[model samples]
Target: CVNCGKLKADLNDTSFADKVKHARDPKTRMSVVWNYCKTKTICETDAIEETDPDMPDEAAPVKKGHGGCGHVQPQIRKEGLKLFLQYKKT
Candidate 1:
C-alpha cells in the first residue's frame, strides 16, 4: 500500500493538479496519473518484517504480487475503466 499512500499524498498536493493541466494530451495526463496510482508489490522479506512477530508465517497475509493488497486492485481497475472511456471519447 506504499504506492497507494504515495498516490494519495501526490493527489493531496495542489501541484499535481497543475501538472495534470499542463500535460500535452489526455494520454500523457493519464500516464502521469497512472504513474502515481499504480500497484506495487511488497517483497516477502519486507512483508514478514512488517507483520506482527507473534503471528505465524502461515497466518500472515503475505503474497507475491498485488494479490495481497486489496485496496490497490480496485483503484487500478477504476483507472483502467477511465482510460478506456477516455480512449472512446477521442
Candidate 2:
C-alpha cells in the first residue's frame, strides 16, 4: 500500500462522502476519510467496460471499480497509546 501510495478504499456517497460533508476542517476531514478507508481489506481496482468489437461505438455502462493499487490492506490498531498495523490472512 505504501509502495503504490494509493487509498485502499473507494469513496462513496453512502458513508464516506456523508461523513466528510460535515467535517469543519481539513484535519477532521482527513480523519474521517482515514477511518473509512482503513477498514477496507482489499485495494480498489479499475472497472473494465465491455465494448462490442463489431460496433465500435457501442459500450456497456460503467462498472464498480477505480484506479487503486491492487494490494492487500492491513488493519490499523490502537493498542493503549501505541498505533500499529495488524496483518492477517485477507
Local distance difference test, candidate 2: 0.71
TM per candidate comes to 0.31, 0.60
Tens digit of lDDT per residue, candidate 2, span 1-90? 654777665665467667888898999998988777766777766765667777655354555665777777676789899989877863
Tens digit per residue, CA lDDT, model 1, 1-90: 433342332333468677887998999998877675453333112133476778878987554432233333222225644732111111
Clashes of each: 0, 0
For each candidate, what is the lDDT? 0.48, 0.71
Q: On a 0 to 1 TM-score scale, where does candidate 1 land against the true structure?
A: 0.31
